[model samples]
Target: MSSDKKVRQATATVTELILETFRLNGRLIEAGDELVRPLELTSARWQVLGAMDRSAVPLPVASIARNMGLSRQAVQRLAKELEKGGLVRFAKNPHHERARLVTMTEKGRAAFAAAMAKQAPWAEALAEGLSPDLLSEALAVLRALRVKLEGHDG
Candidate 1:
């Protein structure tokens, strides 16, 4: 095949992958929202809490956003809402004067635990028929794509 045609074919495949990723992301968020709704947590809130829970130390909103690949403003807004719901609290950051550390409350911990408990079986079922090797390959491809996108200015 001509090099130009090969390039077009590759670009078309990448575009399809991007679109499918977007659809999958939306569906995953919707499923997550349903899974945690009984616990009074939306997917976005759960994500922020999960980030905090996974961190070795409490992080500022900016740090959480960076870890999660989200916008700082979006994370800050979610943090404020989580704080208002009594799920998390903002404490003084010994390093940054204005950027307070986000800590999960007891309530937050319970909610996170419950959400994770729910996730275990759900994830298992989702993976039931999938080959582990294929799953690993998919994960690797997605991570590589993410790294490429992160490095791109456009």
Candidate 2:
């Protein structure tokens, strides 16, 4: 096969992979919405809480935004809701004068844990019958591609 044809095939495969991935992710997010509704947390807010909860130390708002690939303003808004819910605390950052630290409260941790537990069965169901080795390879490739593409306008 010509190199040009191979390149075109690879591009088409990548595009389809991305589109299908997004479609799958959209449904997952919708599921998250339903799961978190009782806790009065949006799916996005839950994501933030989960991130903070898993972090070893408090993350500054800017760092949270960067880690989540969201804008600072978006993180700030979510911080407000998390604060109102008593799911997160905003503390003064020792290093950054203007940036406040964001961390999940104990309640937030428990809530996130529960939410994850609820989702795990679904994830397992979806991932069932897939080869672990193949899945690992695909994940590694996607992770590399994501890092490479990060911050670059597509």
Q: Which candidate has the top score in TM-score?
A: 1
lDDT of each: 0.96, 0.85
Could you tell me the lDDT of residue 51 within candidate 1?
Answer: 96
Regions more than 4 Å wrong, model 1: 152-154
Report the Cα lDDT for candidate 1. 0.96
Per-residue alpha-carbon lDDT of model 1 for 86-129, expressed as tens digits? 99999999999999999999999999999999999999999999
- Name the regions of candidate 2 deviating beyond 4 angstroms: 151-154
TM-score of each: 0.94, 0.89
By summed lDDT, the worst window of 10 consecutive residues in model 1 runs over: 145-154
